[model samples]
Target: MTRRVSAIYFLPLVLAAGFLCFFLDQKINASAAPAGFENIPGRILGSAGEAVGDTLFLKADAYFHGGETFPNRPPETKEELGREGFVEDERENEKTLPAQPAGDWISRVNHEVRRHGHYHLTKDKQKEMLPFFAAAVKLDPRNVPAILTAAFWLDKSFDRSDAAIEILKQGARDNPEAWEIDAALADIYFYRKKDYARGEFHYADALRKAKSGDLTRFRRIDLTYHLAESLNFEGKRALALEAYREAFSLYDVENQTPLKETIRGKIQSLVVGE
Candidate 1:
């Protein structure tokens, strides 16, 4: 009877020990898993959200450029039209239509169309497009393009600079390493809000991030130029002159002669003024 009692006492302890070991093993296994494995689901959702945003953007663009119609189509041959019994007047009308611009014709046409307001989104369309952008950012806080596009439409189309700033601030928080976010925030602060000091800070931050990251040379030059402009506007001429000279030096003269010259002029102006 004493032996039976001792066996009963040990059963609970045995069960407890087994449970502890199982928990430890699970914990170790989880810790051993690849770091990126934990992030796979988030990345997938982010990509899906980006795709949705891109699709919505394309739809909006198509509606803006005349709904349901392909923007480019090869001209119908005269013989083909003649076979279809085209009247002389119709053929003459077709001939009078301007020839489509060659090479990247679609982009050129879209630009001209928007320039002349031949095809543009209405306020309702703009409003319709905003929700998808918001959804995209919600799914992927680090989606820089979605964030920037959303901010742009909010500020430019809806006249909601405050809303744009709020979204951009959220994006900046979510993507601390994104120089584009800082650059965009700088632009809004400088031009829309006329908060030059804040603009200078963000612009400088953007340049720092850009230099530290793998940003292209052309993009760095643009950022530096804007930074100089912000400094100049804030009456920091000495700093602006330094920035402009740096921007000028960054340019590939063979490919960017005009841009380099423009920066040179700014630097000269600053020097002459001094």
Candidate 2:
């Protein structure tokens, strides 16, 4: 069951879904014993919800179910250790949360799946997990969480730049104000397509129009970096440096390796601020 959600761990679409993975596990565990046989159907329903979420967040071009998610252009680095790589200590702390929290049923499931996914994202199981998320997305289209995830992972999985671009564009239109939609679209235009001009315009537009206090609320640090990269590409060094700092600061406190190092390098090398 956990194996199914962990499949697209490499995809970026999952990032916007944020923090849903942990709760999914709790619900499943709580229902395991059951007051009656009624819990059986609930368990299956929960799994199905997760599957739909996965499909929307993961895409084949973004994540391959096979040995390599990115064949020609490997990520070379990962960020935040990912939902799959979050520390056990962090999971323990979350488990400590007194338990009164509330959200839509699907949200909780995604949370639990994110927490439980770490075990499944290992080098040995990545091949199996890769296809899992795509299938999940297929199960649920209204699931913005899965849709964005599929699109982003597809971006990483090889050479589907065009496909990725289309996903973001469509997503942005479907969900105009969502920070995730804006951020995802910005990333595609700048990073994948290498069209800094268009990317900068979009990021700036998002930053400008994104609902007052909401504009500053970043769902993904990667968005900040991509925005900064676009600024740099546009030769706006001062703003670029600022964007770079915002992204680096957003890194998860427990994050190790790839994101930490890669972000630092981008800051020092790309941003002109001394």
Which number leads on TM-score?
1
User: Top lDDT: which candidate number?
Assistant: 1
Give a tens-digit lDDT track for model 2, residues 1-274: 3555555665655664554666766666776433234334334565575454543344443332222222222222134345453322232112223222367888678545532222223444334443554444334434556557657656765456676666566556545666666666677777667889888777766665566566443444656677787887888888888888888787767777676677788778864445
Q: Write the per-residue lDDT of candidate 1 for residues 1-274, one digit (tens) a residue.
A: 3545587788999999999999985786576322244344334454475566556555544454334223332234555445432222232221232344446978677746742212334556657666666666655666688789889988988989999999898888878888888988998998898898899899899888875456788888887888898899989999999999998888665765777888889999999999
Instruction: Give model 1's TM-score versus the native structure.
Output: 0.58
Candidate 2 at 86: error in angstroms?
13
Candidate no. 2 TM-score: 0.41
Task: Give lDDT per model, in order.
Answer: 0.71, 0.56
Identify the runs in model 2 with alpha carbons over 4 angstroms from their true place: 1-118, 122-142, 213-229, 235-274
Lowest lDDT 10-mer window, candidate 1? 86-95
Residue 114 displacement (Å), model 2? 20
The CA-based lDDT of model 2 is what?
A: 0.56
